[model samples]
Target: MRWEFGSILPPEVKYNLCEPEILWFNKYSKCLANYMKSIGDNHGLNLTQDSKPPKSLYIEVRCLVDYGKFELDDGESILLKKNSQHLLPRAQCEPLIRQGILQHITQ
Candidate 1:
């Protein structure tokens, strides 16, 4: 409730749970992948075909003593650590991107 409408919102408050909103990110990620690859191809840089599975990004609870946005579902979930990282690198994102790999993004 600390955020105002249309304001440049800062990071979520401590202990903020963003998993509920993850669906949005999931869709966005796929779309973003497509857009990024297309742009790369248009520029003659995206043409590599990555068959690896996408990576999942989540927060490590045990590590964060403050607030967290994601919860890792790796077996027994842990609490958010203060120094937690929310973004997991897409394993195939860079290599394929750098190799100019392109594929039809599907839902």
Candidate 2:
């Protein structure tokens, strides 16, 4: 039941994912995707769709601040540092890119 690389919801960790929103972040996912979908429907939040931007972009960090760690789609945790370059979904990195913390690198 080990999770494969790039898996956000691995089989073993699936059942252990849920947590109380107030204690953790308001984010959540259920063991049963259908049930989660139904709950989202009741709450008016669509769970099934391409939530990220269609296009991704590569970026290079420019500042010395730690932008925190990001779990990449490839199942790697990156501690973004100055002069580090990474490819990330635009939607996910938009804020940092806008704040001058990261500079876009044309591919």
Candidate 3:
């Protein structure tokens, strides 16, 4: 509900729910948010994004900003500079693309 309706429910909808239901909804929303945060780790992985499996293992991307170094799962670090292009792992760069720091180049 928090993802869809936001933290606070609309006034019209709130009037329809009883006191207990409203309270439960608030508590559930908080718990859900906390759980997501706990699992997100340093990169702040958003579970909602990229729900589908990638068709390819690699993708071409252009850095939108000077994001500095980005390390892969295998400990290989790559320098990311503004307008620099790279063919990187799809899974590893998905978050960066979502953040607008990298633009996926489709051919």
Task: Give the per-residue lDDT digits (tens) of candidate 3, residues 1-107.
Answer: 55667678999989999999999999987887677677834545445455576789899999999999999987999999999999998878887998999999999
- Each model's TM-score? 0.24, 0.36, 0.58
**True-structure Cα RMSD, model 2:** 14.2
Q: Write the per-residue lDDT of candidate 1 for residues 31-81, one digit (tens) a residue.
A: 655665677335333223333444443211122245334333234443344
Lowest-sum lDDT 10-residue window in model 2: 21-30
User: lDDT for every model?
Assistant: 0.38, 0.52, 0.84
> The CA-based lDDT of model 1 is what?
0.38
Which scores higher on lDDT, 1 or 3? 3
Give the lDDT of residue 58 in candidate 1. Answer: 23
For each candidate in turn, give its C-alpha RMSD to the true structure in angstroms. Answer: 18.8, 14.2, 3.8
Candidate 2: list runs displaced more than 4 Å: 1-65, 71-76
Best by TM-score: 3
Ranking by lDDT: 3, 2, 1
